[model samples]
Structure formats: structure tokens, C-alpha cells
Target: MDKKTIATALAMIPILGVNAGADSIETVSNPAPIQRASVKKTVTADVLNVRSGPGTTYSSIGKLYMGNVVEVISESGGWAKINYSGKTGYVSTDYLKSNESSSGGETSKPSGNQKSIQQVTSSILRVRSGAGITYSKVDTLHKGDNVTVESTENGWAKISYSGKSGYVSAVYLKFVEYVDEDSSGGSESSVIRGATVQRSSKSYSLDEMVEVQYIKAQNGGNLISRNNARTGEEVFTTYIIRNAEPRAYGKPTKDELRYYLDPANFEGYSSGLMQFVRLDRYTNTITADSLNKYFASKGTDCVFNGKGQAFIDAAKKYNIDVLYFVSHAMWETGNGKSALAKGQVVTSVDGVTLDKPVTVYNFFGIGAVDGNALEAGKLTAYKNGWTTIEKGIDGAAKWISDGYIHNSKYNQNTVYAMRWNYEYSWHQYATDVNWANGIATMMSSLMEKYGTGEGLLIDIPDYK
Candidate 1:
């Protein structure tokens, strides 16, 4: 595979990937009511503040603009306790006018586009497998999530998300005017809203192969067995270097290699690699506090606090090497400082050149410029629960685990084999001859700081 074929294109676009699963909430809110009983009420105010309680002192959780519709649960002292999204909140009774036409009764039948788009009013709403709360949650949509309504049944709205249909309570649904932001076959947002349909099977290209392996690893299908410890460690080492080489240069020249291998820097890189070796055995044990502190030390402005939890979850869920995964993300994202890491870039699979760009929160730079980047981005969109940090971390971990560690096809499980198996393997992950050494240097650096261990005692022969 021509690695640069896709990477070069991605380089042309702005890099903007931010971690969106961090702790941004001031308080954790509860899910909305499940019982299907309520009276219709419309918000008459231009903007009505939804509070946590039925008083002036209650914290405002969200806002509903004029013409917004909601289900009134009960009446209070000039306040209406309403069901918005999946959460219960209070609004001023004066601003809520009772709809006698549909009060405690079925809504009038929908006509045309009025039934097509529904505005999500809840702060956080779950898209379920079935209509009721008993049905498992397939995904969650935020306050402003776009829903292309397909149909409704018994106060449950069936809407499309990333090409998949799921149910949301109709009580929190509001009919909004249709806005044609992009008439050119919908926007990247539209595609991401329902992007999970299985692609047709074909001869897998390099990117496609990465995608397959990533998904498989995520599903816990492709995992390194304990019996394969020796081979797994070797493959893991190779991946570290493959990732490290991209940091110095696409293909480092002799001087560039020397600059990277200077005794001072080499030791740091080696420490980085050794940390991976130690943490691979630790599995998914990273704590949220530890991760948050690390990010804070690095000055990374993470959007969500659950990111650390997300990494730990992915590591535990997929059996991926935690230290190596975290370090690789730090390297790629500049400790989450890069534009792509910060979630600033927005474009379609074609990147910034497209007519309509899709917001991508890919931390590991997956599918950035490649056609697969868009698909990867959509799969990791917030709606799918693979927010930027989770997407980047999990996607990269799965790719490394499936592509190198315990690779069934190439059998180049060792770093030495991956670097020198030119005659046997069709493609080498990194072309630089000192790729392994470079990663070993990074491993040394990481270990020197955050961990304690003997560095990788590897010998390197310099080429002049």
C-alpha cells in the first residue's frame, strides 16, 4: 500500500480533532420519565429557561425557544413540570400555553415535511432500540441533534442516525422549520447522522484493511492470546516505531534519522517504548484522575472529562495496550494541541476541498485525507459514542492490534521482522530503516518521566 497516497492528501487539509467526551457537565442529570402520560403545552416565550427544579433558584439546564412544543407532566406554583427530551425540568407556566386541541390527546396527523424534521429539546436524549425505556439504548443524541423523522408510534419517534433507525420519545420532539443548508445531496453531517451501513465487500485496500481490522478489534474479535505473548510484544514494538517514524518525517533522510537518534533524544524515545511494554500487560487499568492530570500537565484543553474513562473503557473492552495507545495519541495530537486534536478542522471525506465539510473528531488522524477518513469520522461522531478522544484512541488501538500484533497474514510479529522482512512481506509499515530505534527512543523518554523500568537495551547500527 502507498501510505503517502492518502496521507499527502490529508496534509492538505486543516487538522482539527478534539476530545469531546471529557467532563464538561456542571452536574449529572437524570433520564426523563418513561410513562406515556402527559398534556400538550407550547412555549410562548422567545426563550424559556428549563430549570432543574420548579423554583427561581433552580439551575437552568437548557432553553426552549418560541414555538417549541413539550409535554406538561403536572402543574405547580405558576410553573409547569415538563418532560423535555428524556429529562424532567420546569418552565414558567405563564410562558407555556395549554394546547386544548391536543391536550391529553393524540396530536393532529402530520402533513409533508412537518413530520420530517424534529428538533431535539432535551439536554441528552437516548436513541433506543425500541420505543420505551425498556428497550436498550442504541445511541444518545444531544440537545441540538438533527433527526430526520421517519415515523412515530405511541409517543415514540423513529429517526435516522448514521443510516440506522432508532426510537426517541415524542414528548421531547419539536417540529422545526426545514433549513436547506446544503441542497447538494445533503451535508457531511447528514451522512454522519446515518453512516453505519455496512459497505460492500471487495478486495480490501490498505485503508479498507485498516478499517476492517479496527472494527474487528473494537468488537473483540481480533485479540492477541496470552499464549501469543512473545509474538504480541514483538508486533506491539513494531507498531510503536511505525507511529514514531511518522513524527520525524514521512520517510526520514539519513541526517533526519541522526537528529532523531541523538543519544539524548534516543533515550527518551526508548523510555516511551518500554512504558508500552509494561502497560500492555496492565490492560485497561488507566484511571480517570490519572489521565486528567496527565492532560492538564500537558495543557491539553479537553472538552469532555470522560475521555480518560473512554480510553480505559476501550482498552478494557478491546484488550489493547493502554500505555502505547495513550503515548501514540499524545505523539500524534501533540498532547491534544494539534488543530485536528482540538476539533477545529471540518471537512468531508474529500477534506477541506469538499462543497460541504463534515465535523470530524478523529484524534489519531484516521482517514484524514483518504476516502476512508470520512467513513471513519462518521463512525466516531458524537452520535455513535466514539467522540473525538474515544474515536482516535480506540480506532488507533484496534488498527495496531489487528494490523501488526497477531497479524494472521504477514506473520511479521516482531519489530525486527517488520523492519527487515522485505523479501517476505508485501509492505512494510515504516520505510525508515531505524523505525524501531526511533520508537525505542520515544519509549525511553516516556519511561524516564512517568514510569519506572529498564529501557529497551537495543543496539542500532548507524548508516552514513
Candidate 2:
């Protein structure tokens, strides 16, 4: 039997653009109402986008491109019900070739009881907090963390991170290493220069060593931790599409790594993802007290002390959840969108000249976003404020309404409705998952990788 498509707009309650339409103009005053009852599907697609509405022309919300590997909600006509920039929207299903029989199409509203299984990568790698370079160590590992390789984006590998959304550099991490060896030896054990080799009491049988290499025996031996060699920018191919001439991305790649990795780039900055970030917003936090402190630490960027203090203050204000804020900053600002993608993606070409146009800085993912919000509050996402990161993300799950639910949406489940706009065409269905999941993905990845977390799940910085 065909599911009945009811008109929710008549009720005055919203449902991800699912509300009553073509009814009475008097009923059209509310903001994007949220929720749903059923979902369309639960299959991954080649490319998907969560859009602003059920039809194209609304706007691009997020990109979910990856061949037929990207999972998504079921189908509505030829369109896939998608999450449009933290709201409920739909995208064309023409791009996806893979199909799975799951639920009705409801992108954000999920009513079923589903257990989450993490996606772990093949190799063991370093996990950090705060999405950018200055990651505070959370935990170290030896692979098989989450137990499965759920997804990949650009160069960022998404394993359970620790059950949240942990990420590692795919280029340096070694997803899978295939090597040809000379026979004759079963298993050989060698130590790094100046290191000693140890043997374990859980003795391995001859059958255990495939190509036996000589083993070393120590009194009461123990395995040693390796040094960090996977440092520096990884040169992996990401469809992220960077700009060369005229404009840039997030931050000039150089500035991005420098600011986040080096405490100095933050010399004159303030606290909170918003205030301390954008170059124009620099004056707010760059006080004399800030500068002198940096001069005492690292010593090199002593000249930049005052500038970086804002970050410290912001960290204090938000407490532990501060890391969650970092997720959006690093991704959008590329550490500091001021230098990298500032011009390239934040300009007039995209339609909305973002105030601080960078890849991740598109807070609220306001593709073609220009200027800050007309209002200044938690609700307003304009300007270089956490509001950009906060609302676009925190409100992600319930972004839609109750009138249009299909009962099968989970962060793990993919849907491609962000591609409803011409801007997101290359990323049809969803341009990328990094986008679709929003800030929730940030916290999820952080804790997953680090194995540590604190504070609120959706705590955004205060808006002024």
C-alpha cells in the first residue's frame, strides 16, 4: 500500500518544509518547524546532498559524495529525503545506484531503537582533540579501534575515533600496507636504534609467525612505544576542490597549519570560537596581558602573545565542551579561515559572500554566506560567532519537524538532500558526510579518537 502524503502546512506546525503549503498566507509565519513520523530508506549512495527543501533550487545544505558508498535515507519520488543545512530537506536520488530496504524517508527524525556500531580504520593511529593541529593528546593506539572502517572524507579517516567521531590522517596513517618479503624467516624482531627488544610470555607457536624473523629475548621484556613520524601536512587527494589564484580556502594552507599547530598564530586572539577567530575580530581579545604571557612560553611567537590569549580565555569560558567548538573551527577555518579559504569560498561567486568565507568557516554552512546575522543572539548565526557553528550543528538532528517523519534517521545512516542547490551539484545527494553530520560529528569524532571527553553534547559558545 502506498503511504499517504499528508499536507502538514495546514496545521501551523512545521515538518522540515513538510508543513502545509499553497494553503493560507496567514499560516506561513513560523520558522523551519521540525520532526517526522517515517523515513524513506537507509542505504548509502554514490553521492548525496541534504537540501533546504524537497525540491531543487532551495539551497545546498551539505555534500555526501563518495561513489555508491555513501548511505542515505529512502526515496521520495526520485529524490532522497535529505538534511538541508541542519534542516529537513530532500535531494534527487538519481545519483545513487545502491538501494537498501530500510525505513520511510525522514532525515533527522528517527523513532526506532537502533544501536550504534563504530567504524574503525585498518591501522592504529594518533587521535587528538580539537579538530585542528593543536590537538591535546587523548589516546594512542594500535589499530582495530572501532572495529570497522565506516567512512572516509578527503584525507580524514573516520573510525569510531573512540565511539564519537575520531579522525586520523589517511595519508600518513597507512590504511592498509601491503608488503612483499623475502622468504626464509618466520618472524623477525628488530628494535629501533638504541632500543632493546623484549619477548612476551604468551609465547607464539611456530605456526604463528608467517615469515619468521628472529626474535629477541629480554629478562622481563615489554613492547616499546614508537616515536612520532607522521607529522606535517599530508598530501592526499581530496575532492575538497581548493582555489589557487585570486582567492584561497579557509586559510592560506600555510597560515592554517601555523596558527593551530603553533600557539603563536593565536598571539592576539581572544576566547570563544567566534571572537578569537576571524582577523577582523582580533582586536576584541588581543590585549597586552595576552601578549606578555606568550612571550614567556614557546618564546618564538613572543611577539604574538597578546593575540593568542583569547583562545585560552574562550577555553575557560566554555569549560571542557570548548573542544566541541574547536571541531567547527578547524574544519571550516582550516585552523583559521582568515588566511586559507577566506576569499576563494567566501566570495560573491558562490552567491552569499560569507563574512569569513572558508571551507569550514561557512558556519551554518551558509554556502555563499556573506555578512553576519542581522540579529546577535544564540539563534542568529551571522558574523564570525560560535552561533555559526552552534546552530548549524547543535540543532542538526531535530532540524526538521514532526509532521514529516519516516522513522529511520541516524547519524550513521546517510541521506543526500543537501545537493538541492546548483552550488552543491558536484556533491549531489550529499556533497560530503563531514558536512551532513554538523557539530555533533565534531564531538563524536573528538571523543572517539581521544577516548576522553567532558561537558555538554551540544554546548555552543555564548552569542552576543
Highest lDDT against the true fold, candidate = 1
TM-score of 1: 0.34
Q: What is candidate 2's lDDT per residue for 300-342, written digit by digit as tens? A: 4222233333443443332212333334333443333322222
lDDT of 1 by residue, 1-464 (tens): 48887898867665544435654432233334344457776666767889999766899987776555677887755777887666888889899775554465545332322334555666557889997899999876544344666655444677764345788886566554433322111123211121111111122333433343334334432232122222222333332333343232233333443343233343233332232132222332345666666666655364333477776666665554454556556655555655555664444433435576445465666544445544554544433334455665666666665665435454333343344332333445444444444344444444344443421112222122
Q: Residue 398 CA error for candidate 2 (Å)?
A: 35
Off by over 4 Å in 1: 1-287, 302-306, 344-358, 370-385, 411-426, 432-435, 452-464
Per-candidate clashes come to 43, 118
